[model samples]
Target: MTEHRCPVMIVTSMPYRLAVIFLAGLMALLAGTLVARDAHAQPPHADPAWTDIVVGAGDDGRRLSLTEGHRLVIQLPANPSAGYLWQIEQLDTAIVARQWSSEPDYVGPGDEITGGATQQVLRFVALGEGQTTLQLALRREWESEAPPVGVFTLNLQTVGPFTGANYQYTVPPLTQPPALSPDDIYAEGLPTHFSWCEQGKCTPIRDQGMCGSCWAFATTGVMEAVIKIQDGVERDLSEQYLVSCNTHNWGCSGGYWAHDYHQNRVPPNEPDAGAVFEVEFPYQAKDVPCGAPHTHHEKISSWSHVGGYGLPSVAAIKQAIYAYGPVSVGVCASDAFGSYKGGIFTTDESSKCTGANHAVVLVGWDDGQGIWYLRNSWGTRWGEGGTMRIGYGVSRVGWNASYVVYGQTPYMPIGGATQPRVRLFLPAIARGGGGVAPDAAPVPTPTPVPTPTPTPQPVQQVPSNGGFEDGRVIWSESSQKGWPLIMNTGSLVIAPHQGSWASWLGGDHNEVAALTQSVQVPSASPYLTYWYWINSADSCGKDVARVLVNGTQVDTYDLCAARNTGGWQSRGVNLGAYVGQTVPLQISVTPRGPVDLATVRRFAELAFEVVGLDYRDYVVQDARFVRPADVDLLVGDPRKAKEVLGWEATTSFEDLVRIMVEAELSNPENA
Candidate 1:
């Protein structure tokens, strides 16, 4: 195993005076003088299983089939009317048994007197066998532990063992993951705050309008943080620059932040001239055509994926957020998510998850309080002052997290990962599952947007939302979901180098994710150019990213780029030969190892002969092949067929000459 050393906290976005003061106050709070409040309803030395719920938030209908030894937990929102919290009322204690539990662990700074948000957690395990209902409710006193304000019930079934995929709505049934083993300074502390208020690196929340452009908004958030930390200036880079122009993205419909920030190395539509100022290319929240270069010249050096799939700990997320400002994240956003008002907004499995996709930023996490401070793009009208304090493990907040650094530098894996294991990051953006977006709210810009002269015509447009935006609109998948390629390995993210989205194609063993689309070229001199980012854990992975034109292979890039020029690279191919030909364009990637970024090296921005081209979105299906029937025949390679008949067979040579050979051999009269 490689030693994971913490990066020196050398780059402080603020002056030493401010940093020192913040550090001092936090240190004092964590000192021995810090008081540990007594466990509210439950005793202090409770079982570790007492707080096992880690993924799903608080919905009651959550399905569960816990294994014999595995633990289970239930967490709910609490209202503190005077340090008042909820406790377990009563249970059968037969089929479902309580090992231990805890009252709401409150953590807001000064809201105790005003009844701020609180979270109540309880732990349980399957007693013997059958399924049963676990019911509980709120009460002011602990002795009674009953007479509920609102009844929260969930079914608990004891199954053989957990084998199904962990599909969590909120925090996926809060379960204890492995412990945090990091070198971060704040890894072992209490009440660690990394919000914009504490670090001054994060920017104010901005609305993404009625558009599902959270990916772009999240990307801008990370970029804003990177600029502040590197140069001490906060710039609200243009999401509009991402909305339009980024050919791989479909503007408002939805997009991936990671690919938009890193993968689209060579945008076929417009030039990437760094992060544009807000005034230069302001947000319209609607899909608009590509526009000219807006004013500012600020651009990111590069961005990279951080953290592993099933990321081990909350501390890991906090470490990166503290070190790199706010990090972009994707979560399972539900209608419950849309109507969140205040406190640590939690999730449950009972309510129909109206919206399954969303992107946000993790500004901070409070260990002492058991909550994650999230900054949403829905403007200031939602959550607590435009932010929400969510229970720590809610909705994969820190999962698939990304961070940006200023200036062009080589891209690397998150956690400064140097292992040789191939990584298959899943795609980060998709839409249509939109719940009602908060109505328009004024977006306050702390930084001034600059207006500059713009010029230059855009290159011709091409079909295929190659970026995989628009919810698989232009392309179709050719494989089944249980296949290796269908795992969580490849994912859409908000880290594109140019647009707000790009496709993620992870390699899989034996199975292939063949995404194909058919299009007719509109004019002559048709050309193909695209941007791709790569990552590889080791050199042994067979995952490969390929570009195929007309069923013919054009080029292939592997996950080994981690050893080469290092980050995103753009390549071009002359399509003059097929300029007027209608054909299917296939972009396929497959990985079979620890992960191979064959792992999502997307083909974005198809630039070529512009004009109306007969195009069709094809559903990606597994490349199916049929077997040949048995025939007592043998054939020789007939090179002379081309000379005599002036023809060749698109079918196999064996099939073409099978009948001729059988007839000639059976003609005894010739002998």
Candidate 2:
């Protein structure tokens, strides 16, 4: 190699050359590291189709569909991230059918997108004939830093003419009515003579705790009376036999009225080989022969004594049934009674439970308010624990002066050779208590005082905000615990940077301790204001918030219901027709389901705003900002704001970035 002489500059500045070489090497190393890091850290997948969507239908069984004339509903799951937007379009021709570029205006079947999972009912007529397709798309709202996650395409097809044959079935009348007792007669008023069971005259059927075997007990009680009347012998019928062996029908839990009759009339009595009656079986009746002695006699005798001393109206029948034993009666099988609660009531509200869809015994009635009490076999936990009341003399039971009655004994007796003997069992006496005869003493008469009746109070209407006056506080910190201060308004700026707040859970523990304040509304007003916040993390983790106005719980909004990741929203409720004069607004947040401790770190936010005017005004104003043209632009920049609201982003970009970082760090997955 030729002798290489160092350049004069290199020789003079050896240190500078070394420094340059070191700097270049370091830069190259850094660049390589950065490149490798970038290679590994792929950009997050922003799929607008990954949205959690829920489709629901009303009681009418009509769901949201793209077909014209048919209503369709689309609901977003949980709270949505800010800057979230969506569009509904016809898939066939790529035509933009309907677009929601802003926050949801209405929370019904189709008017909402960004806010929680709301039932949006959209009625559409059939789009031509044949099959037509539709699509739904979602993305991060403009200016939202979080990349859009749940974008989805829904394929909907419309076909054929509307078919109206989807109808519920009905129970036809029985071919032949069951054998009824001749002595049983439906009367309008109390008979002149009445002979009811004395303290030890009749037996009582224990409800068996929560078990809904009232029909069995009532049936057995009737049989016992028949035995006494026909043979001068009182026998304890096996109620447990019907309860345990009636598998084809309801068991210890519940059954229909006809079930008890059918089971008893069936041949080869199938008694549980394992059950024990509380008492020894009495003499057998002439109609049915005794098979095996009942395992035990669970019947009481003094119960009828208490129930027999009541008046002869529907109220008296219900009271007797409730106080002592099950009273057999007729009822209309109307649909409204399907969810009947246990109590004495009388109303014209009838639906499906009419014409004997079911049969039950009226165990009690309320004379003070004319309510008939019936014992159901749907278990004690059902309908006041096996007892419910229908309106007395309201024709709810299909009894217009005359109805069928099949029970142990008749309420009124015609001429007979021998009067029926009724036996009753008293639990109080068995439990070491004194036994009081039903007719031991005359009932004390009430001494009525002559006084002027006070005038009735007029009902007042409640305002929407639950406050009667402007700027009035409906809820305050001192008056409530675990309640959030809600501000209801038409225009509100909700962003992640405001903080990770939840409508239900706010603090680190995700438990609302106490609210700082409460708002009060006039008692005369029927409506009340409510507000709350929900965080994306909390919603994603399954926390829920509920709103209540004047003690009436409106609805429960889960993270899926409120649909606010880190933003604010408002709604108006109608409460202007309550009888109360004053109302209180309440807000509460509870976990929707199980939550992991780690997820609590990514808390959600909740806030409330009350509006005094009708929701239509506020809703209309909010709807004005929703434009299909402005959906794709990023939020915040001068150009975007001008296009949407004719204003610049008041919330700074740096603040928005900081919020994103905090949210990400606090996320349970990240944590």
TM-score of each: 0.35, 0.25
Query: 1-671, model 2: which lDDT tens digit per residue?
Result: 32111100000001111100000000010010000010121223322221222353222223234433343335543211111234433444321133211122224222111111222222123333454445443432222343444444444555445342111111111111121111121122322112223212344433332233434554565445433443455565555555544444445333433223332333245343322332543322111233543543222222232223212344344333322334444443322243445333333322222222233455333322224445443345445555564544443342321112223434333333233232222111211365434223322323334223223123223222222112223223211122222221211122111111111122223333212112233333322222223323232434444444333344444443224312112222333333333433334443332221111001111100121222221221111111111111111223334567766344433344446656766799986
Candidate 1 residues 420-519, lDDT tens each? Answer: 2322112112236632222222223133232231231221235444433344444444532232111110232213332233444442223344545555
CA shift of 227, model 2, Å: 11
542 in model 1: Cα distance from truth in Å? 64
Worst 10 residues of 1 by lDDT: 18-27
